[model samples]
Target: MLEREELKLYNRQIILPELGLAGQEKLKVARVLMIGAGGLGCPVLQYLVAAGVGHVGIVDADVIDISNLHRQILYSIADVGKPKAETAKQKLEWLNPFVELTAYEERLNTENAARLINLYDLIIDGSDNFTTRYLVNDTCVALNKPLVFGSIFKFEGQVSVFNYQDGPNYRDVFPEPPPENEVPNCDETGVIGVLPGIIGTYMANEAIKIICDIGETLSGKLFSMNALDNSMNVYKITKQRQAISAPVAANLAASPDREISMETLSNWLGETPDEICIIDVRETYEFDDYNIGGLNIPLYELQESVDIIPVDKKLVFICQTGQRSKIALQWTESHLKNEKYSLKNGIKHNL
Candidate 1:
């Protein structure tokens, strides 16, 4: 039951024939957990809050940096170095005081993923890495929850609905994580500031439609759009039963062994500067703005520059958020006989 003030606040959306007062109430009862509060999460959080989604939870361990300002409009220069989930909760409360907002200021790892995801009615994957993406997808499959997935790189973005009423999931479409170098994220390729806004709104739209039972949801369909040309395409996705087997779920939940925590890296940089070789695999522009001092070898150029990398020292690869560094580590391990490691959670945690 909406209060008198609540009805007035959402009058515009409530008047729609498809979304009457009942639909508004459905939104008020829906529980959504948004994963990541970065580029894509910004607009999804904004629109859902405005629409009065009753209980919305934000999960992101990262703090804001100046580079995120151009796309993550929910934040400002004042928010730099602050936890994203907490900051989003504060601002979103101001947007819709009637709504309930929860912020989880920790990374969504295997141990906590199921516990956190089970609390929500739907999961929104705004995450940037393949590891987290696959992990979230498998968790949703195991728990039988719907997932609204979105990804953006450069001028293009993709949006889809997965595992809704036994629909195709993320793994059904891709099956395996792409070779990291094959798909460079917004951090590496550089997205036009408005791309996420366009994509994220679509993701929010899917969530609302699913909750209200209005309009055709993108279940088993992948929507791809290019902001440059404003061209869009929708492709039908088929489910592969083997994609969500027990062995696959176990593999997805397993953590890698080559990751070094932020604290350990800091200690090494201080105590063994000569024994450690830090390599920044991010793009040149990212290194120029802010870096912890390392050889700038973008992931694309890593194969050609293998000769310059030292094989004797403990080689540590670093990137904006660690995905590229993991890829760089794989390449270095194959090419050079060195002790390889990747900075866990990436440099974003340090910033």
Candidate 2:
């Protein structure tokens, strides 16, 4: 039974035919776990709480930083230096007292991901790293829980619902992670401030729809949007009968010569200055997080313009962690003959 104040708070959403009192009550009984308290997480958190999500768990290991202010809307200048999850909890509580918000100020790694996810009915991924994203997908798939996923690059964003009722998980669409150094995080590159807001809202919409069984869920489909052109595209994805293996373990267990690290690319940037032929694998938003100064080529874009990379100089690659940079090195070797490059691990590692 919704309290009088709760009904008043959610009156607008309750009025929608798709989401009347019954839907609202369904929402009140649902528990959503949002991974990452960054850009996408902010908007998703705000809207879900405002819509009366009964229990929302926020998981983020990072603290509020000055640079995050541009896109992570949940915090203020005063909130800087505080734990992101804790800060979001405060704001969400203010947004809807009817909802219960739990803040987990810890990073989600393989060891603890399953345990944490087991506590909630649904998981929303706003995490910027591929490792966490893959982990979320695998755990959800194994547990038979649903996941709402969102990601953003320079001008493009993606939204999808993975592992819903054993529907195609992310790996079903992207069976393998892009080669090392391929996809940079927002911290490594830079993202349009509004990109995450748009994608995150769409993610929130998907979560609500999944909870109430209202509209079409983005299951077994990838929704790609280009904010620059205001054009949208949907690609059908099929889950292969094959089990989705752990991409990281596959790459890590490879031979030494087969193994590589951005920081150990002696063949590429051993002696060259940081400026010449360096590629930033971090996403646009991530590049703005912290940078050692380099070219703004995101990981996803590098494959298309490999020739544009300077051959006269050695190329250095960077990303959120070393994973994407390693992929970039392999791609460069496989495609371009004149491109000389090495990986720089991540900005934090170099710093």
Q: What TM-score, computed on C-alpha atoms, does each candidate reach?
A: 0.70, 0.69
Model 2 residue 109 CA deviation (Å) reads: 0.9
Model 1 lDDT tens row, 223-323: 99999988999999987643222221322222467889889988998999999999997767789989999799876567678899877799889987676
Put down candidate 2 lDDT per residue, 112-185, tens digits, no spaces. Answer: 67668878999999999877887677566545678999999989999999887657888777644575678787
Score residue 33 of candidate 2 by CA lDDT. Answer: 98
Instruction: Give the Å error, residue 30, model 2.
Output: 0.4
Choose the strongest candidate by TM-score. 1
Return the lDDT, model 2, position 227: 92
Full-model lDDT, candidate 2: 0.78
> Given candidate 1, what's the lDDT at residue 165?
80
